[model samples]
Target: MPLNEDLPRGDAEYLSQSCFQFHEVPGSKSVTARALFLAAAARGTTVLRMPLVSDDSLGFAEGLAALGYRLEREPDRWTVEGRVRGPAAEEASVFCRDGATTARFLPVLAAAGRGVFRFDASAQMRRRPLGPLTRALRDLGVTLVHQEREDHHPLTVHADGIKGGHVTLDAGLSSQFLTALLLVGPLSEQGLTITVTDLVSAPYVDITVAMMERFGVRVQRDGNTFTVPAQPYTATDYTIEPDASTASYFLAAAALTGHRVTVPGLGSGSLQGDLRFAQVLARMGAHVALAEDHVTVTGAPGGRLAGITVNMRDISDTVPTLAAIAPFADGPVRIEDVYNTRIKECDRLEACAENLRALGVPVHIGRDWIEIHPSRPRPAHIACHDDHRIAMAFSITALRTPGITLDNPGCVKKTFPGFHRALNDLRTIWHRDQ
Candidate 1:
């Protein structure tokens, strides 16, 4: 199953399937971005091992360099020279490609120092709102001026340093809002205390705090309020776990194809909320093994999976993956409480529904939920909407149904660059075994 020989065209239908023993996935984009922020604010050089090197993570690393932070990037490790005082450049312009972490986290990072920094992202990212995070920064006495849109990107931070204090935030839109403020907390004059009225993806905040502790900062959480001391981070060599969200594709693939796929480095001890996607598969009648350091998903015999109604607000990133597989389930798959998907990269709920409909699957769309009816999927070209999750998730459909294509398959560079190649390799192995 050589990519060029087996596939008819670029981003065409996939012609592979198999039960691979294991796969090595890239590092977590969420962890890598947070580590980059923390390392830049630490007291010593930070060595990040196996950090994700995709567009999003690289954009974050590049944003740091644009702000005058020293970084030495290699194949396996990246070393960032910490500067407690923030950006070395007095004036810098950063283009945050298509990464929400880069767009959301970098401006506040610049505010913790003395510099004039301008931040902008791709047109696609510019449409996402950051009003909550921006408003919180202003409340903390930081001068932030959005060049084009308020609470949106193409913004400038007239950095005179953040004298951080207690602030109330609404993290319902994203947890990165809270994590950004948290990463810069230790650098604040009075430290930082955040009282959150609402928060989504709470587990990501856990990852932020746990990673912060490893960098020598303790984040104290008393219910909804999180407190961080004004202490410099002690940079150390950190190892990033495999991205759980990215692993969702493989696990879901196993559950869909009656194959067994094991992903190393993400298990009971991992801090990603998306790891719960395996449990979602379990509820859908897949056999799942969650060891301390690895997770394996084996499909039910004959790939006969039961449909399930699950609320996916916490692990909403994998909603597209589930949506792609729902048509094959024993019953209609109803995924609820995932309104946040509408705001990511594209209106993911609508995108998933539209693509499902294209494949002759009946889909009902609500304000915060999508119900996908069970049916035999027809061959169709999927419109990816330039969202990486949309492309990667729908590619799973091509495994069983031929003629599936992606309008923008390259959009996966936002996280996993070699997604298609990796999936193809798995298919080749499965074919060989058969």
Candidate 2:
């Protein structure tokens, strides 16, 4: 299992749905991964309720288990007996399997403990840059050896423990680099002070800091500088929120089909940055209602949508979701300031343009922007490029436009495994109503 390995394609079954009641999405993958790491590093048993059972999440939990942490799996929840310390194995091997969070964060977690650890991932993760975070860890006095490429994965770390001190991170490439540093900071012997330069996706850092606080650690933030006190994670019972990124697909479905769709259990109060996607839809003329426990979206009756010009740097994960609906907008939809998207699971900007163009939509791709002009989307087989977000986002287009088959629908298993089944259920309800 190396990065960029080919994956099998699956047919995306089209669902004819105009309206549907709220559907419960799975737990947040981001939150679930973070919580698992924290709980594993805590002092006692920690119960996590409603954790997502997806490839990426399960991969992370398995990686932790490989490092000698005890995890008891249940149907809907997980019980993890904390090691109360960083990984102590003499030599631990972790398989990231293209989960960038696991690949990035786990190394830092290992560096915070005593051991020699090696990390490798799927071919895709091997292509992603890990130099910045690796460099930052070295700056914090951890001996990191990149077993493969200089800044890429297949790396090994000889760790005594994190000697927490001041470090500066370049956040221009990916925000997860900053997040990985922050997550390991509290476990350092002297704590950690981080000065982030050229930060992108700042909201995601907010999530890391907030989750740290929930696990009984406070991150002091002043602009780009953060001070993390050396503290031990306390075990507790925690519940994960529904994934806002996964919910974006259904919300876009409501907008694309001129129907109402609701995703329950996540709304305005969510810590996930993708929740801002609902606001983007609202700005694009979809009727978006955010209650305390749920969020709903209703499309215009005639498939009319407003084109908007906005910078999506902080909420770049939803770029594909927005691109899916961009062709039907009243004017050109300009999404800018998302250069980081070029390095995601796929080069999202290029993938969006290529797929939309395949359907005869007028699209202009730039270094950091995509502008989609209103046009009819013809049926085309969308090449998902083995990227989960690309597959899920294009499924939104397939809802209204027929013959739009996703080449790698199985890729959604990385995050939302039951996507097609949930989608088909919508079809069942919508047809019965008809």
The lDDT leader among the candidates is 1
Give the poorly placed runs of model 1, Cα more than 4 Å off: 1-19
TM-score of each: 0.95, 0.94
lDDT value for model 1: 0.89
Model 1, poorest ten-residue lDDT window? 1-10
TM-score of 1: 0.95
- lDDT by residue for model 2 (188-287), tens: 8898999988888887888888888888899998988989988888899999999988998888887777777767777556788888887788788877
lDDT of 1 by residue, 161-211 (tens): 888789999999898899999999999998999999999888889889998
lDDT of each: 0.89, 0.85
